[model samples]
Target: MLDRKTFAEININNYIHNINFIKNKTKTEVIPVLKADAYGHGATQLAKVVENIGIKLIAVAFLGEGINIKKNGVNIETLVFNYATPKSIKENIDGYIYTIGSLEQLTELINFFGKNIKKIKFHLNINTGMNRMGIDIYNLDKIISLIKEYNINIHGAYSHFATADNLDDFIKEQYNNFISAIKYIEDSNINIPVKHICNSAASLFFPEYSLDYVRPGIATYGMQPSDIKIEKELKPVLTWKSTVARVGLLKKGESVSYGRTYFAKETIPTATIPVGYADGYFRQLSNKGYVLIQGKRCNIIGRVCMDQFVVETTQLNNVKLGEEVILIGKQKDNIISAENLASLAGTINYDITSKITKRVPRIYIEEE
Candidate 1:
């Protein structure tokens, strides 16, 4: 039923499996992060799936994303991780939990909502060590003072771990800092019902810090957070695929694609797939990437173009037009993962999948 020559297949079963696996492993509430269109796997659809599975909350990076989820009729509580202006927050206040990281943002909320500020729900973001966002640990007293002054309704308090994947001492330091912030708030008679700091890596590797909730982003989408391996099984939820649009024989010394960076070493079969940098396939993968065709690995031959690229298909018995190609998935006994593409592109797995542009149709598949 797929009409597109190239598309990303979202395996719903695998996604559910990952959610269950993470929840079972951590034994805590899992707050699936659906930001960046659920890492380019299509957020609206995934949000619906998450709700159907009884997940009470999901998180996104922006207010607009949370609004989009609400507009789609997904009733789950959405937590917006990024700061929003007072005007923007007022306009889209329903069904969204905002992260209050700074005194300025908190003041804006108080000023905008006035007495009704108590109706607004939010979580306090504590800056343990990331230093990217959130209230500084030293300044927690000021934040607590303001919260007490306004009688703010803080639903939870959380922090982010910068090196959960690496499993360093810094993680413990960050956790300690988070715990201290929570204690400071509680000492001021402020009740923080839910507390969390573990991301995907920490959720799997450091269950002790799973606290009350785990905000898993990449790992929920079935991608490993880092190079370190975990014993738990997490199936990849996406498979990018395309079809060979053209096939031809390249003679020795003949080059392919832009920049002529690749010249045929000898006579070989070449295939052009309708995928390129514009489609989220990185140009850095120029000559280093490989695609699976007929269960064989076909080496990319030249500079990846904006709309198309050539691959040496000499390993196949016969290269045919419209033959299926696996861009990121299993073929026969071999598999090409997003991690593999990320390695070739000199990036991480998260970048590889999230960069897959919107042009590629996301075809959702669930086994019955």
Candidate 2:
């Protein structure tokens, strides 16, 4: 048994099931995006699971993440979605793919690599509508020109959908724009080996846009994009658990935690858990969130501290120290999913899970 007081149990079998389910549903290859350490689910461990499943590609948000995973032995085709620093661009990128969103970035790489540099694979990021990264659709001429001048290999081109989860019109517009970008690349006689755009939501809802590959981020972790009903089934893989540390009696008129945010209406029994915002438990969920203790939902009753929070266990009988507390997972018939926490925190499931700090150990449950 693990010695940690608070830990997240990661079910690797469920992860494999989700990926295989996705492949079966879409009939398209998947490039698991491990950005933000697989959204705080530990990217390196998940990467190994993905590798063992024979996935050819893995994507990360930045070069450093890709480099770290590579150094840790994730040697499959890793793609860095963000550009690297000029000094470190050539280091640790032997077989890695990089994203080039602008002509200037493309030019920078060409100037640094020079004409005699080895062929480095890169993907063109077309700005369909997100407007965060990617070259403007109108700048295809410049993109084509850069492709001609550089000796880099064009692996693929991709665009992100800003509203693929909800807005149908906007998603279609982005898809059309991506199609136009692809047409321009083809007209320029450029050979892009793989073309992709579908994220988790898009792949599940709009399979038409699942071009050559799909990069599933949150859905790969068994989460839906929104609260809407999903046709495909995906099982959650993470279960955050903590042990009760202390128990106390809160008398009426006495408050709990900082600022006296929670005042007991009457004498009540309370329990403390060794987890707080510092452990990625959101402070916003101070009063709104509830945890499952002894298969009963215990309401959090205080301002969430950096390392501790109190929960009202008055409704439970004989609550004791070292009992299992389910923070974000199913407890008997009830569940406290990331979606549930995110809803209370006024954020998405991605933020809920990714914000979980590394102080809490992640216990991998690998079932053969």
Candidate 3:
């Protein structure tokens, strides 16, 4: 066993299960997004697992991540969705598919490839309504002309949905706009092979727009994108656990942790957990977050330190050193889920998992 007070238990079985579940739901090809190190579940490891299940296409945020996946021996079609700087572009984007949205990116690729380019493929990102990335739909004429002008080997075309998880009216508007863009491509007779737009929530809720491919991120990790309801059983795949470093008796009126933010009204029991903001446990959870100690919920006390935090255990008897502390996972009849922590930290569930720093070791678990 690795000697560490904090570690993440990654359920490999559930990870595969979530992938199969997505494939079943879409009834089409599924491109699992492994950006942010598979949302901090270890991207390379997850890529191997994904490839084992016959998934050919994988998506990452940038070129470095795609290269890392390839370097780690994941021989599959990897797509880089985010923009790349002019300096970052190289002659050899081998074993990778790149996305180009703006004219600048297209020009950069054209300049790099020049006349005699071989087998490099790219996707055209159409900005339907996200307004974050992708070419503006209104500028489709220029985008098409540029693709043909440079004789770019376009493999796919896609757009990201702005509000697929919520706002039904916006979903309809964005879908229509995306369809209009695709119609333009068809009318122009541009035969792009792959076309996708639905994200995790979209794939779950909107089967009609699954298109040629569906990219699922958070749902691939078995977590709902938002509090919005989706009728599917996605097993929780991550369990953040730590050990009680020390147990102590607190005197009446004695404060705990930094800033003396928490004080005892009377003599109380407390346990120090060896996890804090440095480990991606948000400091905002100070005096607000709760953890499971001996199968019961305990309130966090005082300001969460950079490396340690204290939890009030006066409600429990015989709280001892080395007792299990569930930071984000089920413990007996109780649980502290990523969604719970995200709500407390005023962020999304993806932030909760993706921000888990590399300092903490991930222990992969696969049960029979």
**Candidate 1 vs 3: which has more TM-score:** 1
Q: Provide the global lDDT of candidate 2 against the true structure.
A: 0.87
243-266 per-residue lDDT for model 1 (tens digits): 999998899999888788988879
- Taking all chains together, each candidate's TM-score versus the true structure is 0.98, 0.97, 0.96
lDDT of 3 by residue, 120-189 (tens): 6788888888888988867778778877776778899898988888837787788888888888887887
Poorest 10 consecutive residues by lDDT, candidate 1: 224-233
TM-score for model 1? 0.98
Q: What is the lDDT of residue 179 in candidate 3?
A: 84
Question: On a 0 to 1 TM-score scale, where does candidate 2 land against the true structure?
Answer: 0.97
Top candidate (TM-score) = 1
Arrange candidates by lDDT, descending. 1, 2, 3
What clash pairs does model 1 have?
A: none
Candidate 2: list runs displaced more than 4 Å.
Answer: 1-4
Q: How many collisions between residues are there in candidate 3?
A: 0
Model 1: CA > 4 A from native: 1-4
Off by over 4 Å in 3: 86-91, 230-232
Clashing pairs in 3: none
